[model samples]
Target: MISTYRAVVLTRNGGLDALELRELPLEAPGPGQVRLRVRATGVGFTDIIMRRGYHPDAPKLPFTPGYEVVGDVEAIGPGVTGFTPGQRVAALTVHGGYAESIIRDAGEFIPVPEGLDDAEVTALILNYVTAYQMIHRVARLRAGQSALVTGAGGGVGTALLQLLRVAGVQAYGVDSPPKAGLVRELGATFIDSRERPFDEAVRKRLPEGVDVAFDGIGGDSIARCTRAVRRGGRLISYGFTSAVGRHGGGDNVGGLSGLLALFVGTRLLGRRPSVYGITQLYQKDPSLLREDLSQLFTLLAERRIQPLIAHRLPLLAGRAGQELLERGGIRGKIILLRDVPKKT
Candidate 1:
């Protein structure tokens, strides 16, 4: 068993400088928990949000930031079943995934299929699952319908496009100019968000508006995108990427209020466009997350969908990875490899 491992700890809320790489003693899994020798961890905007002390669910300082990991089970605690040491698995951890090894509730760990890339599996846990749930569970998107995905070049945005393709739904993606080709390759009609009047750009194409609109870039963007949803359509707000640099240290009350007003106003106009804000961490049922992850794994095993890996950096490069994500315009998921050989 490994005695000590390197981990990226958030010493305090700030920028990339807050992330500290330190060697720490590893702990054994308690009952109903299992320890994993992490192979790779996903680098996401949520991590940055937490680092900036914006995420409401973020833990106290000196915590790890990764939300998902793919690794082999290194040890199993008492009362844990359905898994054995050396089994490959992927688990969603609210934190602690930035470490080379982590202990998580056994229920949170899903056994990964053999022959799948670790980075791909890591991508599926958070980004793909969120997209799948939003489209299938929340929006209930149907075949032949149309939907608009804002921030459509990022991890979850691309996932939405891929899943929408399999469902036979027409997808319209809003992203920057440089990501236009990637959006097209993922089977979505690209609309450059940098262009003014984004809502008009979308409505001009659909005319009657789309069946649904998924907005992760919150703030006024949500109100504007709501205009692209047809009557009886749904608008799902998953993240507040636009509120990142705003004053007041990540409190998004004003932006959320604007979104609420839009929803109310649309209903008063008899449009009945439903608006929803999603935070997967607040989900009450663990089984539902497990089930969703299982279905996504099946899709991956069948080669029905593929996750785009934008960059793969060593675990120690956590600071640099976060910097890259903060710069924006990334095409897909950035992953941190945990077991990479260290420099001599």
Candidate 2:
């Protein structure tokens, strides 16, 4: 068996330089665990926050930063059943996925159907599932209802538009001028928040407001989203990009406290305030993630949804992939494919 593998470790909280590509020792899978030969992992803004040492959920420095990965089973520990070597699987690792191999609890992974692209599958594990659960489970939006999606053209934002279109929901997507075309292409009415504030743009188009609004760009963006929501409509705050600064250099505590204050203030206005964190929800019930992800896999199989991949970089380019995501202007997800060798 292989003894060591390459991984991108966050040596210290800082800029892109903090991520170091190094060879790390590998260990045998412990009981109830499986070692995965990672095929692809996703690079997201959450990883950016974690890298900057601002994310409250981040582990100590000098750890991996990947949140989700798709891989083939390399080995299985004793007491783990129903999994054989070479089986492709996906997991919500939340860390340790920016490596060539990872040993995780068997229960953390679900069997991935054959024929699906590994990079696309990695996108679904976090982006699509979050979109799916927020729309169906949290917002519980039904067909024909109108909703607003902020940060449209982002990983989760694009996922929301695609899934909303599939569900027959009318979507108004708020984004920058660059992403307007992509958002509209996904069957959403595009609102360029950069041209005008998203709340004003949404309200101008939807005088009565929308049935629901999904805002991932937190901070004052939360309150802006609530304004676009109808009296009885709900606003779901899923992320805090602004709070943490898209490229870092933001205050974590201030951002979170401000988020809570907005929730309370929005509630006082008689608007239903809600929040959705895929990790937190998954922790409450792992089966929900399994079920939702299974459905997403089927959706991909049927070609009902497509994960827009902005860039496919080699595993060692994890830091570069994240830099692209942070710089923005990309329409969709950035994937780190382990099978692709980094250019020398």
Off by over 4 Å in 1: 246-257, 269-282, 339-344
Candidate 2 per-residue lDDT over residues 142-170, each given as its tens digit: 99899999889899999999999999999
Residue lDDT tens for model 1, 278-322: 344335667767888889889999988999998989966778888
- Candidate that would win on lDDT: 2
Q: Cα RMSD for candidate 2?
A: 2.0
**lDDT for each of the candidates?**
0.83, 0.89
Q: What is candidate 2's CA lDDT for residue 97?
A: 83
Please give the RMSD of candidate 1 to the true structure.
2.7
lDDT of 2 at 164: 98
